[model samples]
Target: MATTEGDQKLDKSTPEGAWKKLLSAQEYHILREKGTEPAGSGQYNKFYEQGTYVCAGCGTPLYESETKFNSGCGWPAYYDNLPGAVERHEDRAYGMIRTEITCANCGGHLGHVFKGEGFPTPTNERHCVNSVSVKFKPKE
Candidate 1:
């Protein structure tokens, strides 16, 4: 088996059962089980601080503070992500087509990205991420 770059960041020695024990029920559900937290109920929904946002599962830097914006969509909104920080896939769940974003390093479900919603961003795109899927590291 080849040890990919992603495999180096996240500890793979831990078994699935150990991961269940390592994370909380909610974190497990959102990060591992591909579940979503309720909108407007996230810690980062209204949080704006000077720092970088990293993946909760693997601590890979995903977004910078300057990329964040207030979309009033009840979630942490970013105009962009750090280069190659996340991967996008076609999500066709729940009778809807959406672009699903996940941590490139750990493959944890971050949230979805949407475009053409009329947001004043350089790319006119929105990376709507789940708070539980990320951790904020304040600049020091």
Candidate 2:
């Protein structure tokens, strides 16, 4: 079986059904069902190695390591994403208006992006992503 840079398996068939079989339950829950993992529990929340963050569902390169920062909000936070990698949609679930970020390639839910939080990064935005939705590929 061929794997992506993040080591996530790829299925070239129809996404609607193939994803359910390709991804794990947790990955499907968050990636397909727009579920969020508990804060501070994701593996990449505290991990600070040089790497690229890719979508777990399709393995599309989404975020770069340099853009990641310690925002203390839990669930790996990034200040920016790779160009043309992520897509933002208006998410009004849970009685709150938020911008949900997803993999542009596979339409997999990654997490939400919070803006105007006054972060020190170039963009005052925090991309709070679930670890189950992404995988790390260390720089070679």
Candidate 3:
């Protein structure tokens, strides 16, 4: 993605320590440490209010409310993201070859993106993101 502090990897080379200092324990775990919130427990799992979702780490606009959908996956699901708002990487964690999504601005771990589940979205993609990894700004 375009060069941005958030686009860089969260590691020792980056200002991870500074980010940790600014984030809560939960936020740090989910965003910086690439952890997942328990399904159905995230604040945004059932939230459908009109808003734009931004990266929790660096406040980068990521997804719009129009793209949000009910995927019955117990997490905030989106059909798409703002262009260049996120970057995808091959995640081999837990022996699964899934695509991991990270904020293009702050490089915080948002969650995974899946496809071919017959979703009725234009892209047929499900961006299952952790609520803690993002913040909502209701359209005014």
Instruction: Output the number of the lDDT-best candidate.
Output: 3
Give candidate 1's TM-score: 0.89
Please, what is the TM-score per model? 0.89, 0.90, 0.90
How many Å off is the CA of 64 in candidate 2?
0.6
Backbone clashes under 3 angstroms, per model = 0, 0, 4
RMSD of each: 4.0, 3.5, 4.0
The global Cα lDDT (0 to 1) of model 2 is: 0.88
For model 1, state the Cα shift of residue 105 in Å.
0.7
Score candidate 3 by TM-score against the native: 0.90
Off by over 4 Å in 2: 1-13
Cα lDDT tens digits for candidate 2, 1-140: 33645565553333567677777899889999999999998999999999899888877899999999999988999999999889999999999999999888778899999999999999999999999999999999
Give the whole-model CA lDDT for all candidates, comma-separated: 0.86, 0.88, 0.89
Q: Report the CA-based lDDT of candidate 3 relative to the real structure.
A: 0.89
Candidate number that wins on lDDT, 1 or 2: 2
**Over the stretch 29-110, how does candidate 3's per-residue lDDT look in tens digits?**
9999999999999999999999899988777789999999999999999999999889999999998899999998678999
Which scores greater on lDDT, model 2 or model 3? 3
For candidate 1, the per-residue lDDT at 50 reads: 96
